[model samples]
Target: MSETISPAQFHRAPGVTDWRVTGTGPQAVFAARSLGEASGLVAPVVAAAERFGVRPDVDVRPEAVVVRVPPGPDGIPAAATDFAAAVSQAAHELGMTPDPSRVQSVGLYVAQHSAADARPFFVAALGYEELGDTDAVDPLRCGPQLAFNPITGDVPSRGRTHLDVFVPADQAPARVEAALAAGGRLVDDSYAPAWWSLASPENHGVDIASWTDTTD
Candidate 1:
């Protein structure tokens, strides 16, 4: 076993604690206060995740180093090096050399599912007005509104992500009924005088939470 060192013997590296990584897949990238101001590049980290398909497991620190991918034939030297080089160029544009060590992006993807007959529930029942439609990323609309996209496959096993939409203190029940009348199946009815959860038949769930200020 290697010998353990004490705090007095620790060495510090310059620019070590200065970056953040986020996201996964093709969208992976790094973020920092600024790039000259940044000590590294962003793309390689994304590339690493894309090629390796796994992110580093982190533990033991507020600022963690997550190696977003594992080494293998897919993440061979050539790809890794190329990704690093791309990161270098990106850094140069920002007035610095590449530091592949730091990369990440913050992003979220929500998959909305609905029936071919999804409109009335969103429009009439939910009291949501249609915003507009665009083909660039399929139709996206917001609702006092629950906008859904038609999907043709087995329903997902479980929801990986969910949103908690807090209703106005007095509007909770109305919102819940609107959801129900519109064919949104209800799954749970228990509440702690604070919040309740509702799930659609398809298992898309939402939590209606009550807001309370401390002065109470």
Candidate 2:
């Protein structure tokens, strides 16, 4: 069983908002209207983390900069609060916005006849290491987590590629509701407490997931 962080545990830190606390760490995304703005934030944020003796994993995309603070002795929430505050201050000074709603972690799904047969190919091709028996993850914590799902029967019309969007456990219900309200449909809830499958109007699949135990 993986360690799970609850909303209460995450929210205990003051001034930390919009950060999704996971088993590994706390993550947040800052939105940049332009690539230049996103680029500008990297140095200052990195410097700030270094000043605090923490190294954060940062991914700067064209529209956003995602930061994840790994768990330390001070703990993830504390470290994340410090990192997020630094980044938020830097972003504000640069006229950028911290969009907590955009904070999400994605996992890639590959439907295969047998995970045993397919896992090795992806592990070698992507230079990814195994996380569990069926999942391969980026050692650098940059790329999306890859999950190989066993498909024993004929392939579905929807295809093999699907995405898992991980959010805080407390936020899952609202996220699911928002998706359904936005013209999406529920595909399956049989995997609840782990994930809920949803399909877009175009039938593209996505799963809304929570890292914490949601079995209750």
Candidate 3:
């Protein structure tokens, strides 16, 4: 064969913050270095989360920051009317527009409380199967996966999780409203008619949405 050379792969800095844009797709993956950095990107995602009734969690690591876009039927569409608003807010907060070229795969996680009897309820109610358990680590689900762990006191300020709930989308709105009727208050009202978050009876919060795109 004739001598040929392939393009070299460029290795980016570990945890480099980036905004993922691919082929007019609906998902928007954001990467960053700190909570402060991710704040710039939070507004649009938060608004979308509220409209779609999903929660977008801020995946914070010492090395990098990640904002995983929630999926739809219940997920906010990549082209949401409020999308730009959210992004602009983040831009103001970050002091720069996030680099779109450095995007990476999204990360997902879940939490419960150490004191709560959540395992049985998760398995039976949410259809989450057990994966494994450790003394320190919470029980994990390998299929229809569930990441059950002790609540770390409180959710991060201006942050939430893109959780998967085993409920119908049409039913989500009513369920959420009922929770409110039962005295549950909204975490934020920025996004509506799409996703609305509410604190649960146990004070553990859940994002009620229409779809289940979790890695179960």
Candidate 4:
């Protein structure tokens, strides 16, 4: 297996300014003017991955082409930086620029005393694969990862399950503000730029986490 790299190292890699180390892996979004143009990027991205012998998940939309380096046990492979850089360079050749504002990912979290005990149920119910011992991931990777968060004493008032929204660091504050303006209340900001937990008007739980992909 190739060596694994830390998020910090990935961020510092050359030609990867367009990429971000998200909760799951290194990802980037290149903005395109049309669906045809976006689709044009798919082959080049796949070619880069083939050249590097790495797998990348690419999503083409009308306005953007997103490429994500699939992560391994420890983290993403060191070669992921090369893949990301190659993809970025190819997008640049097409007159596409990376859009940090559009780069984000989401995950589901379950608060419980025993993460292991609850793992099986979610795995069976959602048809997800076990990620290590206490987490589960969607096999198709189309859904958010579900992680079990341990709690000791009291159950959170918001509920047992919550959503963790991972956005670019620069876009985090505005995301929190918009949630609050839309009837959500700030439950906690003790973590500041790391994360801010909020409760919807109906008492659902969500955490805005922004610690990923930053240099601080």
Candidate 2 Cα RMSD after full superposition onto the native fold (Å): 5.1
Task: Specify the highest-TM-score model's number.
Answer: 4
Error of 4 at 48 (Å): 0.9
Clashes of 4: 0
Better of 3 and 4 by lDDT: 4
lDDT per residue as tens, model 1, 24-107: 211112334543343333344455436634333221122322232222222222233334334434544655432233332221
The 0-to-1 C-alpha lDDT of every candidate, in the order given, reads 0.37, 0.73, 0.42, 0.86
Q: Write the per-residue lDDT of candidate 3 for residues 1-216, one digit (tens) a residue.
A: 222111010012122223232111122334456666655455655765676444454544433444543333222343332343454345546655443333322212355444554556556765554445611112331233445556567543323334433333234567678778897878864554445666765675655543331111
Candidate 1 lDDT at 184 equals 83
Better of 2 and 3 by lDDT: 2
Model 4 / residue 62 / CA error / Å: 2.0
Model 2, 176: alpha-carbon shift in Å?
3.7
Task: List ranges where model 4 is wrong by over 4 Å.
Answer: 155-159
* Candidate 4 clashing pairs, residues 3+ apart or interchain: none
By TM-score: ranked, best first: 4, 2, 3, 1
Model 2 alpha-carbon miss at residue 105, Å: 1.7
lDDT of 1 at 12: 24
Better of 1 and 2 by lDDT: 2
**Cα-based RMSD of the predictions, in order?**
17.0, 5.1, 18.7, 2.4
